[model samples]
Target chain A: MSIIIDQLNYTYSPGTAYEKQALKDISLVIEDGEFIGLIGHTGSGKSTLIQHLNGLVKATGGSVYYNGADIYDADYNLKELRTKVGLVFQYPEHQLFETTVLKDVQFGPKNLSLTPLEVDLRAYGALKQVGIPDDLIDASPFELSGGQKRRVAIAGVLAMEPEVLILDEPTAGLDPKGRDEILDQIAKIHDERHITVILVSHSMEDVAKYVGRIIVMDHGRAVFDGAPKKVFSHYKELEGIGLAAPQVTYAVNALRERGILVKTDATTVQEAKAAVLAVWKG
Target chain B: MIRDITIGQYYPADSVLHRLDPRVKLTGTLVYIVSLFLVKNLWGYLIAALALAAVIRASKVPFGYIVKGLKAVVILLLFTVCFNLFLTSGTPVFEWKFIRITKEGLYLAFSMAVRLTLLILGSSLMTFTTTPNELTDGMESLLSPLKKLHVPVHEVAMMMSIALRFIPILLEETDKIMKAQQARGADFESGGIIKRAKAMIPILIPLFISAFRRAGDLAMAMEARCYRGGAGRTKMKPLHYHGRDAGAWITMAMFVAVIVVSRRF
Candidate 1:
């Protein structure tokens, strides 16, 4: 039900002159039904870490446990593990290959050896979860708007009925409205399904708003792991690693500098608004 | 699992072979391959092998890395050896129904195997030491005479370099697409040949779309950069021949001389 990564290390092209160590001794526990944000700058091993979770990339050292069972052990079924822990990669829309959106969404469940009826059912349910209109479901995914195409792609993973859903930069390359919609839909899925959700992103604001806990990775190590408020309070140290809290947190800190009483840890627009209102009323 | 492809891949290093003029390396490879074929006896082959070993040592590229390039042509080498073993006419050492192993056949097979290995290794050496840009520059320079015959030599060289550059990029894209499909419970393994081929459709379609999209983007970029046809082009850093290049030519001349003398004897 939970994933425990112990001392994971990965090096690409080991022993070659082009060898590069991508991940270094990264150990963490993702408890059941937890909404976690894994944030890091580019080349910070974020993609490599998520790939390890689903067994896409094997760890050179250490082990990953799913529900207290070592996933890398000889007996574990890798396909079953991949289904249980779904990964929606960055620019996931490019993965869509079926002619129609519904067919593309059904690809996952179909591959699970489900009955055709069951596969379609799961696909329909996933499409509904992602809120794709029925008419658009019959249209070619390539012909849809960029945002719609992305939703279908997400639905493709959602149809797998994974217990632990990991999204790597799910809101990347989306317009502001599209980004908000995706974030809200992801939050809705987490709440309704009660599944463990790990969002990998570099946009500090997006993760700050939704994820209860944030794990900040820098140079292949999780440097900070705590609640969003507690982590954002260390904004100075976060910025040292090329990361920042949400703009509102900076704004709140600016207001505090003028001797106004406000919580400097506010990350979302609503939290900043409420904090400002509270100070004004006081 | 598909990352083992090393064809046309360059290994950057600071060594005499790596720093040699691309034209010299290219011409040297050609001469070396021709000389490898000219070897008539064991002594000639030994000389050629020594020359190859010297080049490998001077390049500072790992001996194992250069040897690994031989893996790509293993099947071809085996086929040539097999063909030479059973087909060449000579005094028979072992004879069976429709199968004859002769002394000359054995010698021919051995020599052909060695020649093929050297051929692949020699070409791989040139590519491993030379960057794609330099290779294209050398190729365009070598083919510059073809321009007199109305051939678009520059464009042809550009195409070759672009194709060479995109090999790794396309492989990376294929890897990503395969992983994406696998995440969705697609099993690429554990299938019969036909079933496995069917499974590849999901990967192929997306890869092709992305590749075409990339091609379009690259075309646009080239056009935006005002990349006209190679007519009236001026080089940014024109090819220069140093004293080492002269030494390289002398060495090539000596290699050819040895092969000529071996053939004469």
Candidate 2:
């Protein structure tokens, strides 16, 4: 299944003093099983754009297609579209209201009218996927630490077995260690399930390390959409919008500036390592 | 989609009413509401309507915008009109099978409808001109005399302002949580009343939790900065009455006088 957005436009509070055009005439396509990174500055329409994929937001103009079917059609089933395109919001732990971690995760599958046995199985599978401990399954989600609660929230969406998973700033407010753990687990989920993943983050390092494709949004327009290496290579343009490339991109550029030739397109540490080793062999 | 509310929304403008002191606007709104209740005749309503029109004009807020607020109060308006028309007893102006329309009843209903419409418009006008901060500041100063009765007036005002500030924040939070739950296949629409109320559980629980957490954090942050009671606290922008405020006060008094005089006839 694929998702396609064509010439989308969205304006907030039209005809009022607070009116703002959040998304411009933007278009993009998402293929199945592709791990994509969506990055933007605050209010750059990243949140608004992701909201469109699940029909949480309707575009004022243009159209959205899911699996080659127009999602805006009068007869389109939006509830099903929402389930198929699961969205894990920022600080999603705030949405966890169930008594137990297992119950919270099961909420989604149960909403699908699944049999009790299937609900429990999918919930268990999701909990395991997010690496929730067996002992904590019956524990109140509210009692868990911040990171644990966040994982349960993600499990809540994952239990639905969505075809596409979109996470908005999943690592926000988490420490570096927690951030790495969540992203790595998401990568594993994408690999194991072969489901499409859209990771929305403001952090350059987080997206560069995991996502194969990066879409850069600026002032309601997608400024760059390409592989991490190609997108990060325009570090100058990225820096102009209060964003910078990953550390390795800057380090490689710095190396080139200091009269040592290195592949400046390297966006991650491993790629920088390979480039430096190649230069060292010379 | 919850952004359609127009009541209690401030309209930014540099008109006479907006430039006047918020205390004047507050007092004007209170007196206007009281006068609305006091008036008993068509002449009184006409005077009140004129005053409202003048205030709206001076407020620089579009008349249509002020009228939009009446949408929420439409049912109440109709209820008031119907009760005064059919239930009121007097000389019959029109008669149908079981329906009786009396001359006095018709007059009462007309006056009642006008009174209600004016009440809503007059009140919303103040909100359109005065922002919440200015309002709280005005209320705090106005209620300062009540501090002698151990009312914790300053703290109450602070709490009130904070609550006002949290409305939009909590609304945005509600939107986020609702969408998060919806993404989990939670159906909020297409349900019976009981089912719909149950659907709200997910949104309400998280909203209350987050609101309390925010309150706790705010209390700590205030305490961290050595915030004590209101005794020694000074304002960043103190409320002061300008010439425009005095003029507004005189105009409000005159508006009340005219309505009160017209009520006597």
Top lDDT hit: 1
User: lDDT (0-100) at residue A215 of candidate 1?
Assistant: 94
RMSD of 1: 1.9
- Docking quality class, candidate 1: medium
Q: Candidate 1, which segments miss by more than 4 Å at Cα?
A: B86-104
RMSD, candidate 2, Å:
2.3
Q: For candidate 1, lDDT tens digit of each residue in B1-265? A: 6666676778888999988999999889988988887789988888888888998899887888777767778898889999999999989999989999999999999999888887888888898899999999999999899999999999999999889888889989999999999999999998899999999999999999999999999999999989897988888979999999999999999989988888766
Residue A265, candidate 2: Cα error in Å is: 1.5
- Cα-based TM-score, every candidate: 0.95, 0.94
Clashing pairs in 1: A1-A67
All DockQ scores = 0.77, 0.72
Please provide, for model 2 over A75-121, each residue's C-alpha lDDT reduced to its tens digit, 9 standing for 90 to 100.
99999999899999989999999888999899999999999999999
- The i-RMS of every model, in angstroms, reads 1.1, 1.5
Worst 10-residue lDDT window for candidate 1 chain B reads B1-10
